[model samples]
Each structure stands twice: as structure tokens, then as C-alpha cells.
Target: MRTTLNIEDDVLAETKVWARRQGLSAVQVVFRLLRFVLSGGMEQAETGSAVVAGFRRFQETSPKLVTNEQIDQLRDQVGL
Candidate 1:
């Protein structure tokens, strides 16, 4: 699936910045954008809290700053 693209320099720079902020590679960000557009753009399905593996997911309530380092540390502790 590798191919060359003629993306503008400014757009590619912006995408790289955004990808760094999200802890993802530039290619991953591009694919996510493509999927989002192809799947009806902002018209999403029903919204609700989702449960995975018997655990209900919820938004974080802490107002503390959570850095990528902290996330990686936790992931390592849990052997993720």
C-alpha cells in the first residue's frame, strides 16, 4: 500500500505537528483522516458510553495534566 503523494509542504508540516501531539505517526494520522471523511464525515452513529471486556468506559474527571510519559509508564506497568 505504499505510494508517493504530492502533499503541500505546509500541510505536511501541520500534519506532522498534529500527529506528534496525538502520539501517532504522520501516516497513521492521514489514514484516520481518510477513514473519517469516507465514513460520512461528522454524521456519526449513536453516542453512549461503551463497555469493553466487561468494563464500562467513562471520561476522565481529573484536571491534572497527563503527559505521554505518564501514559507510557502506566502501560508498561500493566504489561500492555
Candidate 2:
């Protein structure tokens, strides 16, 4: 199947960069992105929960680098 679509300049540029980084052609990158989007893999509501849960798990397992009090102190020092 073939069709014509107008992609934004910035999007085209970024897609080219992504293609080069991934060792794929611009067409391949667009195809993959379109497939992902068409399949609803990029649905924010569905994905956001999983991403939030993963972050929560990571936060629980990871060591904290700074405390809220420390952040507040730094912010005060910076007159923020």
C-alpha cells in the first residue's frame, strides 16, 4: 500500500535522525511508528498506568539521592 502524507519539517528531521541512530531508513522508521500508533501501543491512558507503576517500583527499590528537606534548603538558598 502507498499513500502521500505531509509530515511536519521538525518531525521529518527528527525521524531522519532517529533512522540514522537506529540503522533504519526513514521509511522503516515511519512504518514502525505508524504501526505502533495504529495498534494503540502509544495510547497514553493505557500506557501511563504501567509507566507509573514501573516508576513506583523503581523508586521503592532505588536509594534516594536527596531528601525533601535537602531540596527545600537548596531551593531556599537559590531564592527559588
Pick by TM-score: which candidate is best?
2
State candidate 2's TM-score: 0.54
lDDT at residue 15 of model 2 (Cα atoms): 99
TM-score of 1: 0.50
The candidate that wins on lDDT is 2
lDDT (C-alpha) at residue 33 in model 2: 90
- Stretches > 4 Å off in candidate 2: 44-46, 49-80
Model 1 regions more than 4 Å off: 42-80
Backbone clash pairs for candidate 2 read none
| lDDT computed for candidate 2 | 0.79
User: Which tens-of-lDDT digit does each residue in 1-80 have in candidate 2?
Assistant: 88998999999999999999999999999999989877556654343543443342232455668989999999999999
Q: Write the per-residue lDDT of candidate 1 for residues 1-80, one digit (tens) a residue.
A: 78998999999999999999999999999999889756645233222443445454444567589899999999999999
- Which stretch of 10 consecutive residues in model 1 shows the poorest summed lDDT? 42-51
